[model samples]
Target chain A: MGISAVKYLLVFVVSVLLQVLFCNNILIARVIAPFIYILFIVLLPFDTPRSLLLFLSLALGLTIDVFTNTPGVHASACLIIGFLRPVILNLITSRETLESVAAPRVKTMGFHWFVTYTIFMVVIHHFFLFFIEAFTFEGFLLTLLRIVLSSVLSIALILLSQYLIFRK
Target chain B: MKNLFKLIYRYHVVFLFVLLETLSLSMVVTFNNYQRAAFFDSGNFLSGTLFEKFSSFAQIFEFKQVNIKMAEENAVLRSALQEMLLKSNHGTYHSSDSIYLPRIARDSSQKAVYRFTTARVINNSVNQQHNFITINKGRHDGIKPDMGVISNGQVVGLVTNVSENFSTVISLLNSKWKISAKIKRNDYFGSLSWDGKDYRRVQLNEMPYHVPVQNGDTVVTTGYSSSFPEGIIIGTISDFSIGSGSNFYKIEVMLAADFKNLVIVGLIENKQLNEIKHLESLNKYGN
Candidate 1:
């Protein structure tokens, strides 16, 4: 494997461990908890192969699912985000930067672009995760609240870690 | 064949995406069916060990909350014991229907009625519409599906799935849960269900409007099914109103057990459940 591939694997391990061990237990206000494991998917090299990306997303989600005891909820959500990542990148980044940019970081991509990208991905991930978990529209408002609150927390944490850990 | 190969290669990413999503969703849909028979859940070896380690470390900070809940449970148990003693002393216990004593005497020909097993709640959730609780006891501990769970003499939920060493309970707060309940004063029975709105309040429907239902009236299970015994405390009527153009009363009840603070519970196994079901099924064909 290449050096960059090894680095991405390390990031995946750290993100999953942080999420299952600490974030899962921290129930803020007895409702919302941040899920930062999506950071591994968001920070993958810009030109990562689509099949590789999809497989990594599945593995990441299943690992978290094994810990949380919700078998497929996370896996399905992660898969959706992985399939749409390329489309979201094309929409957010110009062709000139798309060809040049190696990875998605606050330094590589401008602050505004990174923030928008993280927010969009986090919202979509949380929306699918919460809806699939509930499996019904009975409590629509409550589920919406959970999705919104959790997305905000997740985006904030992802951005903080990107700036602190990925300083370049 | 060359053109077909090129087409397949071009759309392979989309095909893989669809394949993985379908597999994951099927896993979610069939989760309940295979969960009990298989050990792929959090209760299994690898995942269970990881959770156990995390919990042991996290439990230190939760000690204060655990202590408070224990104290509250102790208070509820003490009050219940005092009430039972008072009833026995006043000579009113035998007159009323008592769950502890069976209507039939202990004769050698009669089999056991109900058996109780204690379990600890390792994980619980009340925030979701369909809530489930995971208990540390399971099939190895004489627990099975369709068993009724109670805490401090109040209704908690029903056991729906069980593995070798763990069981999942459908909490009373879940929208799918329903129980046969009646007013303590008049024996007027109604179907109790949750509205998925609040954790503390559940709704009792189909009560005849003429029945003099009042706030604070006690509600208890009717024991109509083998899942739970008769006279188990469910809740108390908190509010009631007659729906317009309807002949039934819409009553709201405050649940007896605080699901959010649940830790220890009792699993009730009806020893006569199979026999009762067998006899009832015999009557289905008008025999």
Candidate 2:
């Protein structure tokens, strides 16, 4: 694997481990549990193959599910965000940038584009995850609270980590 | 075949998305414990009513068998009652005597702790994020909010809303509903809540780490809430673990009631619920 590919692999393993071990336990107000594992999917190279992206996201989600004992909840939500990653990236950046950008990060996409991209993907992922986890709209407000809080925490963590690790 | 192959290759990305989503969703619905329950949650009023009608119709065909079973049970109950009457007439009966009776029958003179009202589930949904069961009996039938609903002998859900002739139940499979449950063996109680992925399993939270919970141990409602009676079977413990730096065990319970095939259910009316709520509300204001 190339250096960047190796780095991506390392990021995947580290993100999944951190999510399973630490982030899963950090429940603020018994609602906001930060799911930083989606960071790996968020950070994949912009031009990653659609099929490969889907498969990798499935593996990542299922792995998290195995650790958390939630079976397919994570996998389902992650697959959705993964499939939409390209679309979200396309919408936020120009064709030239999309072709040239190696991976989505604060430095590469600039702060504005990167923030918007992260917010879209994180919101979609969290919305799907919490709704599927609850499986009903009866507690619309509670589910919304969980989605918003978790997305904020996940986005903050993703952005902070990007700055700390990928900053030039 | 060539044209089909071309079409498949052309929209391969969309096809793959569909395939992966299908796989993931099926795994979620099939493997998780609550989706199956959601299937019969009675949230979808039309389909739920149709299902209830169909099941009840099917039940009519088995009435002969049911009557036989009921007759046999009644015979056994009569013999048991005869023995009790004999003991009492012989002046050998004591209030503390250990004669096994259903919990509802223990208090001879006092009002029943639980009054069961049979209701047919009219609508249900298990595939959704939040599931509710609509039952036929409602305010007209004296059904009220917070009543516990059950099928067969297993805990089902709680009555959350009631209309003049209909009521909605918050299924146990719903993530919003939580019940106080305990291990049948040790009386170690915890909060049982659905994870929304499975219809067959739920999570028991706040179980102390010291409790030696084992797989397959029975979990039952703790009767801490007026919603459900004490000792109603919820499920069996399927798995459990203590997370690092946590003092509680995270337990997975396999629900006992098959939510996929819910038909006739009983709504439990707690006679003392209003009084308890009134007293508790008074205490809340420190009055």
Candidate 3:
């Protein structure tokens, strides 16, 4: 348990660093900003306490907010997803499957299940983030376009990391 | 009371979620107001140092482009200097001696109006509706809020927040930031603001339709605000049209500065800003 806790802490730091140094810099098409830092919250062990998950989400989101200069947008989005993670997990996986699997990774949960979970989570995150950043529905279509494009990029990166780093 | 406590305990996660969201959303609202300097920004110590460190590595890839732009700016300055020397020797009357003189000489003749210092952009974003640029200079470097920032002889942004070692600039691409601008051909002025649609294009509002504005006509700063001096090149008129039944023309300007490739920027500190503001306040009270 002690080693596992240290490992999770390492993942948190790595995710935030990767996001601030690498992911934030890649603004494809001038609108899409890939946010893969949510991987820390998304891939947390399913048996993790609900309160612990929410707190961790707040920390992760606030860190990204500081780097990007968007104070509360990422925080609010992360909170919503963190609170809903279990409900979404319950919707997707059976009781026995979740009890056996330690966390939601491509290696443990299989490709299809993990992809669906990531898509749902990333979409919720980016949608809330972009709209809150906009703060208005003035150019509703344009904001929606940005959310879609950014989510596609973020989802792709999150899935790729599962294979490349979390395979073991 | 016991039942209430039990109910709270039963849904404590939901309550915690709501409380946290409220805190975050309030932060968003306060930040949007533009004057409340929130501490949760990249300009703070830890993140600012982190951005500066990583940006140094990333900027290595952009050095070639930065070098080329600097050389071009140097060439322009050199030609302007040559012209000034030629005119001075000819005894020709130059309307503005202060423009060509150094700060020491200018201060001897008249109060220094503006002082400039350059800084490297450690972080910048162009896509967001409320975009900000972070620079390496801050309070220790004499950077303060409300100072104007320019790059490549064009408007880049205005300083909004200053920390110990870094400052955050409100980018021109931000929809909330508006600057006073005028047409070069005619003295007609208007408020220039971004539409959150394009980074390269901004809208110049309140220009009466009767003014003969044409495509390619240069738009420059009005000098009405202390943030910028008179006649800084903002952009050229791209496309314009008047909405039906409206007296003003909707002028679209293509910004001169390519914000995406910004590396170095000049900050303009208005020395007379406080004095002017002080006098204005006194006049209001005196009346």
Candidate 4:
């Protein structure tokens, strides 16, 4: 319990700081921004209670929200991303995958599978975020452009960050 | 019963996420009338302090340029002061919405709706009809929507959206934006618009053809706008002509500010913008 608590807390603080200081600042094409902090929610323990992860995700999202001054944009995006993480993870990891020793890193799940999991969640989170930011169909084209550009930039950054932090 | 419990437990994370996202987006969609959540804006206490740190760095790089700009501005102010000093005219020139600022950055506050703020153009898009300029200001810097943005002395566009520490500005060159302005020499005015073909040239329309026009006349704000002061220096008349079939003039004004080389900027905030908007709305409702 102590070990698990320590790890979760560590990821939480580090993820929030990283998102505010670096990932959010790195604008590719001036439209694309990386919400790399979603990975903290993504990497929560498998047996962590559904209620707990859900609660934690809300807390994590809101903290970033306060820092970002976006009202509830990040909180909602993080919550949705955090919630769907397990469903996607379950789908990505197949039968007999339980015995896997390495965690969610590339060593445990090969590069292809890892990319698939990260890309799928990132796209969903980004899609919802860009749509909410627009908040109107009058901005349909602008919103769509933002989603496409931001998604690509986010995917690249997520992959690179993961490689550096969780080296194979 | 056990299977039911298991299913709920298994998908619980998904359920919670959807709920939270719904809550956040609802806040945005409902900002029409009741702005209860406005207090939680990016300009709120903690976030403002964090962004203020970066604003310091941005201010540092701007020191040399800012000094030069102040000197030129001082010269302009002194001349304006000279006119006022001789004639004893102090209150007439200031437009009702124009509030004198000790510093331009202080105008970026909660009361600012049409406020303009500066950011370094790290990247920008001009070819697209919906061009956006990515700037270093974001949620932390009190940047918000519908805020009129400018670079140098010319109108750029508005703050369309914001992130935590940075934001994206919709450039005036974008097809979606049409800014309010008037001729400096005459009251004849029109909407300043972009054609999406060239970033350098934008078109001004709606000027009556009957109005006496010259090639090198000054065009200033009408003082009819809540966003800009009476003489914020938008541009100079470059060319004009009467369309073959229309009653209005088609004119192009050469912008005084070099749009491409814009770095530091001062955002304008109309002090009385909200009250005026409210009054306009009330009249529409009454009608």
- What's the TM-score of every candidate structure? 0.81, 0.49, 0.92, 0.62
Task: For model 3, state the Cα shift of residue A133 in Å.
Answer: 0.8
Residue-level lDDT of model 3, residues A69-139, one tens digit each, is 88888899999899999999999999999898898888777889988999999999889988898899988
Worst 10 residues of 3 chain B by lDDT: B90-99
lDDT of 3 by residue, B1-287 (tens): 99999999999999999999999999888887655455777888998998899889987888888899999987976786677567554332234423353333233445546777889999888767878899999999999899999987699999999998899998998888899999998879999999888888999999997899899999999878878887789999999998789999999999999988888898888877787788778888777
Question: Candidate 2: what lDDT?
Answer: 0.75
Tell me each candidate's i-RMS in Å: 2.8, 11.9, 1.5, 6.0
Chain B TM-score for each model? 0.78, 0.68, 0.89, 0.62
- Between which residue pairs do clashes occur in model 3? none
**Weakest 10 consecutive residues, lDDT, candidate 4 chain B?**
B99-108
lDDT of 1 by residue, B1-287 (tens): 99998998999999999999999998878873423334445555565555556655766888888788778877976676577566554322332222333433212444346677788777666655556677777789888889999998899998877778777787888776788999988999999988866778899999998899999999999989778877889999999998999999999999999887776788888877887799999999995
The parts of candidate 3 lying over 4 Å away from their true place are B36-38, B82-109, B282-287
> Can you tell me which runs of candidate 1 are displaced by over 4 Å?
A2-35, A66-69, A95-100, A137-142, A161-168, B31-40, B64-75, B78-112, B240-250, B281-287
DockQ each = 0.50, 0.14, 0.70, 0.28
Candidate 3 - chain A - TM:
0.96
Model number with the top DockQ: 3
Predicted candidate 1 versus true structure: per-residue lDDT over A1-168, tens digit per residue: 588878888898888878866676555664586888999999998898899889989999888776565677789999999999999999988888988988888887889999999998999999999889888887799889888988898999888897677564
Evaluated against the true chain A, what TM-score does chain A of model 4 have?
Answer: 0.89
TM-score of chain B of 2: 0.68
CA-only RMSD, every prediction: 4.6, 17.9, 3.2, 8.4
Off by over 4 Å in 4: A2-7, A67-69, A95-103, A137-145, A163-168, B1-15, B32-36, B57-221, B225-227, B233-287
Q: After superposition, how far is residue A137 of candidate 4 from its true place, in Å?
A: 4.4
